[model samples]
Target: MQVQFGVLGPVVAWDGAGDAIALKGPRHRAVLARLIIARRRVVPVFRLVEDLWTDPPADAVGAVRTFVAALRRALEPERPPRAPARLLLTEGPGYALRAEPGAVDAWRFEQAVAATATLPPKEVFARLEEALGWWRGPAYAEFADQPWVRAERSRLAELRLHAVERQAEARLGLGLAAEAVPDLDAHVAEHPWREDAWRLLALALYRTGRQGDALAVLRRARTLLVEQLGVDPGPGLRGLEADILGHAAHLAPAPGPGGAAGRVWAQTAAAYDRTVPSGARVRLESTVGLLRNLAVTGGSGLQAARRHRVAAVAAAEELGDAELTARVIGVYDVPAIWTRVDDPEQAAQVVAAAERTLTALPPGGHEAARARLLATIALESRGPLPQARRAGRTPSARGPQAARQAEEIARRLDDAALLAFALNAVFMQTFHRAGLAPRRDEIGVELVALSARHGLATSEVLGHLIRLQARSALADFPGADHHATAADRLAERHELPLVGVFTQWYAALRTAATGPAAAAEAEAAYRNAAARLDGAGMPGLEHGLLPLALLCLRVQHAQPAQAEEHTDWGPYEPWARPLALLAQDRRSEAAAALRKVPDPPHDLLFEALWCLTAQAAIAVGDRQTMERAYIQLTPAAAELAGAGSGLLTLGPVSKHLSDLATALRRPR
Candidate 1:
């Protein structure tokens, strides 16, 4: 059976009989459009409800279901015997389209262009030409007045232009200069002000040895530029024109210093080494400049790798010392991996150089320098224990240990800000390992006080403080409120995305102590936090506190899907599975899942608490299990109680906990 989907150009379709299938009504078209693009994937009913009704009247869900049914019927007017679902099928919690790959015209266009990348120049040109020929006019022209369709049409148009540009480049590279010239000229006539197209045209003309024509083209471009925007051609365009006139050899683009985009890449690398923070305005500006430069000098494959190495080394040099340079290079490794440009040999060599530099440092001569060296080593090695051990040692027992000596020097030098920064890094390592919470808290508080005194608003410090406070409250430690309030105020002032997450966790804990209404409030807060987090591009893997928040909120809300979506237990898959199963009310499955969680390290309080909570929830008849959970959580409960929330009543695992317990107690 034949069915066509079109998002690019006019809305058109044909049925199995090859008869025109007309789609009428704006909203109906929109519903179909969304389903087609999100093809095969089940877009949740709630999301569709939101789309169809901006201020959905009561029965929004029902209205959405009606729309789905209507769309399905429209697509399959004459359902054949034993035929598969024509357009849509009900899947878990939502609907999915059943269209085959390339059944959609939009998908066909993309496939054609992607195939062109591997084909010969003539073939590439032909494929793109055919793909472009599919467009009958402005995309979804009948629905152009609709906001979503308009935006989608704009995106498709951009894609078409990109395909054209790439095809033109291939044609020119194949020495088909005269062949590309007319099409490029037509493109220029349509988009006369686009400098890249003009540049391509000029290059194509020059390549055919039409030097005079190329110069004339540049002259026309300059005139157009002056008339349109009252500006001369940019440096690159002007340089190209000069080259053509002088008959000079074409210049090869040079790899940037350290392979960074532009001058600022080198500058930012230097600044990073000099103790400047990551998100500073100066560093960001430099990063932007470097990116712009890199775009201008396009390199592929091995050339790209060489350019990145150059950039890394330049950054290392700007950082000043050998260790700092190595650390800067290590930072480059993350992007290199994503871009598939990582060089293990180069990385190892840099690390070796850093170690040598550290080894060669004179005893007790420079405390700050020594600390910097150690910090760089710690960062490069990715071994926190080794770093902690190294940091624990003094440069000389009597003369000056690096950490202590560095602290003293910071005090004497009136550099509290730097002192705070140094201490924060140390705290990060300590907090990650077992049995270091007290020390972590002390150092974190000190850092916060120092930062506050120095008029600093550090998100890093605030985030650490929030985690420490939550831990302290859980462990029943002192000063939880002070830390919690401090974290809350800082997060509110900055509109920090993570703060909402922590706030929800705090609310859940409070609710469990108080009552169901409080628990419901916590659930609402968690939902709000999740919505806010949806678009924010926080690091996917390094969400240290978010998992903890999700665990707490899951108990409060009893929503398994929400819990699963946020749980990121790196390498602890077995442990996470039980928690997920339990949250979903699969009692026996959840209990079975728990055997996978390895025994916790003795000092890891939170892990123990979670285990106890799980065990108690799974074995309701066993008073011993509940008692043990109470015993483990008592200290944490007391600490939170002391922080002035009366809800800190600890015992028979509250309503959320009781639900799990009840589920577990039911007949198998």
Candidate 2:
């Protein structure tokens, strides 16, 4: 009997006939997944209790044992009654699943990565392809939303990414860099922060006799390291760069950190006082340089950026150098989030001051650079209020055309910095001009490369946020959460103030859609986020806030106070007139008022509005209103049936729609 058990993506068992055997249920599937990841290592019962349940049941031990027993039966239906389990055995301390190496897909992938040393280049590539093919989705994709499962899946996903990185290296190693050039180029483009991959791409270029191209890669990498990280390239990379410059004959491919420790850490680490000559006394020039260096290092966060800006201001005042002043301000005036330090008004003031200063500067390259900086600042500091967004028809909103134009301009300029700036600029515009930017998710990947390659800290934060927004907009909640996690981590590590509000909004939406106490928490989060949204001054807040208020009302998370007789939804007053009617206890009028709403934008809010309308109409026994509303709402209703909160009501929303269809048909 040939059976394959895979935990590479979904936990599944398949027979030799190429059909998947069903594996189901929350707890049961989790138990099997844990065993597969455990990889025959004994997992203690105590560990299982904590991993499986946040608040373990009083009979948690009994439940875990029950789940394991069920899994054993599902795995081996022919096992003799009362016989000791052979495959899943209860060992001295705990339980273990004994399976051959090839049976588990994760183990196979690990093996392929490990066995590359013994295999030829083509063979290594083939094995990696085979290993990668086994993944049906994200590792333990079905269980990823579960906190316990998330940690393990993230670990596996990283391992999978490394495998891809290694496979690309193999392609370069096999003298196939010409064939590998396009892929390696794109790979490095998407993950430009990865110095090892950059090194590989450079080696590929040199091996292909494109020595000049190889030098260009190293120079850009070196510049990015100095500009973004405030550190020089590591010794191996520097040595390789030098050798490439000299057209060294022995320029062999050197792997990144995967090869050695020397490939990773910068060798420019000086012990102490070496530069100061044993405390002869530090000077103002050196101090200012350190402050300037602090501006570029990625992980130092918002305070570091501010410190550089302030110090540079003082230096300019003392020295009376206009160009130096502009350069410092230009570098640090990047768009970022703040907790409370710089609110909307203060940010507006900063923008005004910067504009005034720019007018005083002599027009030249400095002016152009200052203008670009001003554009970035305005993007963060001034745009539209939260309510300015509407998914209205627009012939000009097609995103790819604008992005391609910017891309072409950047390329024609032959400037990496300009290209990085263009990518981010185009990325921000996608949200503002919305025809539901197709493949918006891919933008995050390019931004990731751009930020890393050029050391753009704002792009790093925006890249993650873009993915978060794209994932949520698509209703891929699990993927959204993944991006949210990365965004939060980067925000904290980098001290990004602007990222907090955007991440908060995403988190609230996800929680509102699915949390156990969805209404109460989501309402609070959305209200706080609404204030921040107003502060952001980005377009779409008008459309964005309407949904939140409607959701809050629909969930009964926070009902409108009786004192509020009218809802001033700004330009959307006509479309939102029903909320005011409902708040005033005019349920009949509320149902009638909704007739003014135009065709919905075909987004989550579309479902929210119609569901609320159907509820209001039902209260008034307006069968005609219900029938008309349900016709437009049916498809969205069916898709969102299981989703809780006001987006689609929890109980039988689909059933309710069906029943209404039946009632409408039966009546005169």
lDDT of 2 by residue, 1-668 (tens): 55578777667887665567666577787887787778889988888888888899899989888988887787776789999887788997678988778877878777777887688666888788778778888888778777666777888887877877788777765545555667778877777677887787788777665677788988888888889889888876788888888877566445543323322211111222225564222233344445544433333333464545455455554555555555544444343222112333434443444444566677755534554444334343323222112324231232234345546656666666655655564554443322232344686777767777777666766666666655554556787678778877877887655566666666666666664466767667667777765534333343335354543445333354222544446533544466557767887777777665554333324444455555555555768677776776554443333232112222334544655566566432
The lDDT, on a scale of 0 to 1, for candidate 1 is 0.53
The estimated TM-scores of all candidates read: 0.44, 0.36
User: Residue 217's C-alpha lDDT in candidate 1?
Assistant: 90
The parts of candidate 1 lying over 4 Å away from their true place are 1-357, 360-364, 375-414, 430-441, 459-514, 535-537, 540-572, 579-593, 600-668
State the displacement of the C-alpha of residue 604, model 1, in Å, after optimal TM-score superposition: 8.9
Considering every candidate listed, which one attains the maximal lDDT? Answer: 2
Weakest 10 consecutive residues of candidate 2 by summed lDDT:
262-271
